[model samples]
Target: MNQEFIDHIKALIKNKAQSQLKDELQKLHPADIAELLNDLSYTEAKDIYRLLDNEIAADVLVEMDEDIRKDFLELLPSATIAKRFIDHMDTDDAVDLMRDLDTEKQSEILSHIDDVEQAGNIVDLLKYDEHTAGGLMATEMVKVNENLSMPECLKEMRAQAEELDEIHYVYVVDDDDRLQGVFPLKKVITSPSVSKVKHVMKKDPISVKVDTPLDEVAQIIEKYDLVALPVVDSIGRLAGIITVDDVMDEIREQAEKDYQLASGLSQDVETDDNLFKQTKARLPWLLIGMIGGMGNSILIEGFESTLTTEMSYYIPLIGGTGGNVGTQSSALVVQGLANSSLDSKETVKQVSKEAVVALVNATIISMLVYIFNFFRFGPTAIITYSVSLSLFSVVMFASIFGTLVPMTLERLKIDPAIATGPFISITNDIVGMMFYMMLTRLLS
Candidate 1:
């Protein structure tokens, strides 16, 4: 991604120098080629793509952003796509590309694919839900029967490893293809060749069912520090394997989705998205904030006669403080839920802990404001007591309200992230105004 390399590629593309372009592409990694393509126009990108070897082309296709890849694929013929990219890609990557196409297009691509086994694997993967372990697993792992000797196992592995790009672990299966153990790659060189594979293999290997959720699969891989995890059918037969790279992609996507929701976006969106798409994702939360502002205005107007100009000056402070406190509380709850550190069952404990923290914060903030107002307005002034008291009450209420809302959302099987940012801030602003007006009236 250096400027000099990019400029060289751009110059070659501009001159229509296919020979130089192919030479430069061969020296760059597939990901770097993808980055160059992203910076180019459709025609320019197509030219660069055509220069890549089939294996590199397949890798570059996977590295491209999903939106860009879809448009790129549409410009190519089905036969070319199948023969050049799909045939060389891993089963998981092929399934991902197929998921983006229509049924007719998928069928056409599958028919054009030269490898029958790869096509069959893609079709079987397409049958599973996209958010499950089956959808994330690949049929490229090396497995051997437990009854085979070490020499026999190594021979079988050589044949299987030829088709795969990387080998992390060798699985040992029984006569029924049931996953029984895992044999480490290092054992092939270190262990005695006279022994059967089962004797050297570690028994009771860790694995997930094909029906397991993607989130749980990610957690297992992360917890065990595994390079790859095995997937099994209900009957304990080996189905496929999910690599660490695939789990990393899922984790990154989930993090981005949560960040978007917390920022008040209704859907996944990028800066390069069209104006209509950007507006649609942002408008709902903006409308909610508008309604909340109107509600606060009405609440203030109801107490207009009870307040002097001095009291009116403190309205912004009350609303802004509450909003800040509420946003902080909701953000913490959302993050805890996402990282699995907070459980819905422990809602009471979390709220209680938040209350203690809020109490200390409320007392310090209220006292500082009270001291400042007391010097300006004198000890007997209604503005002094009412502003400070309203602040204390608002802080306590906002903190508890924010903590409870997200936790309740999680308990109800809803995404808790939506309760953060603008949603909590707007709700707290309206409630804070109501509290300020009520406290002033009662004190006066």
Candidate 2:
């Protein structure tokens, strides 16, 4: 991560000093190695990747940016990718990596994977909707039958723990494999060995169905402060476990996606993406904004006869105020929805609160603008009263419109984030112009 270390690595790569590069890479963490790979050309990165052992390479692959990892994966054969990387990766991570590949490539990679069980688990995971708990869950977890004694449970846990990197909880299941309870890791040392697992374990454990949405899964984990959450099938059978680390990744990805949507991007994009990709992601929103601008011009043209030079000077102020207010309202609504702080049922309550806030803001802003206009024009001037009234109306309308649009979208099962930024601003701008022109004409 340091500049000097990066410069040294680049020099070693340039000089083709394989021994030094291997020694240096071994000293760094997988995530740090991934950061270095991101800064290097694909060929240079691949050279460094080849020096890593299979386990570290798998970890490094997971840590790299998706676009870079995709390109890197393409350079390797299915056999090497499967036997070397996928075999060493967690089920959820393997599914994530495989999802980016074509069907044929996925099949080939599966075929080459040495562990039949792992390949099967990946295939099963791929069947779930990518946005759900099942897709994020991994089969790697420690579980024991509820009938086992504490000593027996501990023995079984030891065997299962060998296959896992870390053990968060020991799940207890019935004869039917239905999840009955959770065996706390602390109980292993504290509890007496005479008791059965079912008696010793905490009964009625909190869990999620496989079909639960990824966002809800994140909320559950966060709310419970869990390091892992159990996933259940329709029959209440324990299917897999979702680790906190994976849930954290899901949370980050969702936040990034929402942020992109709020910014008016049509798709996920990064600065390193190709020109065409970047253009494609940005152009749709830009075109929409342009259309909105043209529409505003036409609206102004329609009201041309009513607008005196003084009246026309206030148009920008009205539109800009409305757009700024709308954007702020929509952003708050979108963030509240994302974090589960705002419920669809609370729409009326939220809008009412927003209206009160808007009223305060509108009153202050309109009063300030009116005072300035009254001093500049005569107090009796139509422009003064009309402009002030229009500002007040536009602020109230923009705030209410912004709050309701996103909440309505969410109610309709649409992503509310799309209603933020440009969409809200454009809508508020056009409507603000109409309010100003209509109020002015009537007042005059």
Candidate 3:
């Protein structure tokens, strides 16, 4: 699907040129147009979007990344964006787009949205925190009274068919509008006319509270394999449903955030972000690393006299091998943390695998380092055996710490993201240095 449409559109845009691109974009569905837009130059995309209907434009805008959407909004004048276009969007998307706009611009966009119901919906959706169920759910779910017979349920659902295009399940609610159960569309259509919705509905549907963390919600969704899940208020009244598509987006966003945090950048870092912002986000980490390196320099200075007196030919060789060993251990532990594949049940297995991998690499590299030094310096290289042993011990200990630190942090209610950044690097460096010094002393 990605290749077929994208290639065809590419030929149209690139071969036929800008005028043809604009004309071709008009013929595409909003989602398809969105895909095409993603591939185009920002100026070309803007021009093509102007040629399309506002309703189509709005749909594509919602589908776009926040960067592209913000840029598009900046280009379009308020008058061209119709009330129907804004009204057609889901409340969550509307709120997200609006939140990016300046207060005055947000008000201007809101003023253009004349539909009171849509306006109120966007307002209500904006009230919830972004990580919670209220922020994640779509307001487009189907609801019906519990008293309705299966025939009545079918009739009511059919009556509302025009308004329920995206409906996957129908909710059963009490007179007070509190959710009692949910009935999938298939069940309603297949059940006997005499059977009430109560007889067919799932009494306790999988749901998340409005304030539940996004990660926890994602975990529940994964654990249950739910195509869609309902969101409820503190009072247990159903508000909306979060779809699989939205959950997938949340997962990608979270993964990106983890990457950025691990690299010591802002969670919002993007290719389109300004240079100054990117630098500001990255500067702290570089500075911290520099300071940490300075500490390493100081430690080396303290050991300088010992090194000078020992006059070891194997120092360079040992240093190179130890660095490589420490790096390999750090990489494995980081991978294990990111995958969450290492848990208490498999802790022993993961540690053993890590140890074997680290040990093998350390031994091979250290043996080569010792061999080269022995040939070059004649018996002075015996010190390398001690250096190699120390490096092996450091890597083994570092791997264990790397695995346990995140686990312990999570248990203590700290975000595990902290373990990925300066924390891990600094801790590993300290441990690695200690290993080097201890080995040097024993060898001397």
Candidate 4:
């Protein structure tokens, strides 16, 4: 959004010039409107929102950041929210919005929704845990009975197409509504010479169960290069469909969350969040890093008698090098796990591979540091050999430690992202200090 346009809207809002503000809003996209809302105060947002038509309001609401949308939605009445926004959203989006509200608020909003089928679908979807395939799938889809004739299937498709805004794929189901196959759109138009839908449909389609984890669903879709995947019940009955767009949106959200974790935030947070919330999300890791710093100091104090003053000068180099090596190893492991390129079962293979890479990295780094120190201080000085050996030991140990932590976390069903950033850096800093001091003592 243009800064001039936003300032103009603000001025119009301040002046209470509703007519001109509405006209200008009409010229902007829903995403632009959403961005403007995020930048405005509650009263100003509400004023600008009132000028939008129900459909556009719904679109803007969806486009807004979840934090901004949740705060904005709370100020609206249940009936106003239901009629003006939820009614226009897809069932999946509706579920997402509803999840933000309390059960009582959700019930009140659902009661205000005019479409009984849409309301029922949202209710059924709410029964699912939010991180599963069922919660992400939409009840809206076109399906034909496997036993239907070509003409019958076409009629069914025409009738169903009337309800949906867009169609990704046509599904074929048995008498029990158990998913059987996918009926291609091209096959539908050409009216393939087959007698029944069963003969023409592509059987044994790729799919996931309703309770499948969101990660598994994303991987299956990406692996198959599918635009959409059918969701099935425990008994193999078709429940809903997951379109790739929805999956992509979820993947983006998860990526943001993981990025935040890697940056040391303990919880979900946004820039729009108030001071307390932002502090709460950030303080835990900062405190942990502080403790790790204290621990490193105590280690140095304990080894002070054995450590030379010159060795202290090289502590920063060793600690920083260790942290960098650890961070790189954990990041690669996390990325591999996310893309399914590295199997959790293959932890030994991954660690073994990382060790070989670390050996090469450790050798190169130690040699470079040794040569630098050799030129600065004579090769006979114990400090020269101590710092170089410490660098080599720290690099190898940090690399192996970083790789092991995330792999263990993955096997234990913990988010591997926590293994990055402060967690790895703090740990490596303390351990690297210990390595430098011990190697210095031995060489002395």
**Top model by lDDT, which number?**
2
lDDT of each: 0.91, 0.92, 0.70, 0.91
Name the 10 consecutive residues with the lowest summed lDDT in model 4.
Answer: 186-195
- Stretches of candidate 2 off by over 4 Å are none
Of candidates 3 and 2, the better by TM-score: 2
TM-score of 3: 0.81
Per-residue lDDT of model 3, residues 1-444, tens digit only? 377766766676556476777666667778877767777777667656657766677788888778777777776666454363576677767777777677777767777787777777777887788767778777877788888998888788878667654777788888887889988788866888888888888888888888887776777878888888888888888888888888788778887876787667745677767998888888888888788778876776777755643344544443444444444454455455545554534656766776777667666756775676576657655454665676566656665665666656655766566566665666567556666766776677
What TM-score does structure 4 among the candidates reach? 0.96
User: What CA RMSD would you report for each candidate?
Assistant: 1.6, 1.2, 4.6, 1.7
lDDT (tens digit, per residue) of candidate 1 on 184-221:
88888888999899999999999999999888898888
Model 1 — TM-score against the truth?
0.96
What is the C-alpha lDDT profile of model 2 across 1-444, one tens digit per residue?
Answer: 888988899999999999999999989999999999999888788789879999999999999999888888887899999988998998999999998888999999999988999999999999999899999999999999999988899899999898888888889999999999999988888888998888888999999999999999999999989999999999999999999999999889888988898898999999989999999999999999999999999998999899898988888899899999998999999889877999977999999999999999999999999999889997999998998999999999999999999999999999998988689989999999999999988987
User: How many clashes show up per model?
Assistant: 0, 0, 0, 0
- Candidate No. with top TM-score: 2
lDDT of 3: 0.70
Task: Using lDDT, rank the candidates from best to worst.
Answer: 2, 4, 1, 3
Q: Against the true structure, what is each candidate's TM-score?
A: 0.96, 0.98, 0.81, 0.96
- Tally clashing residue pairs in candidate 1: 0
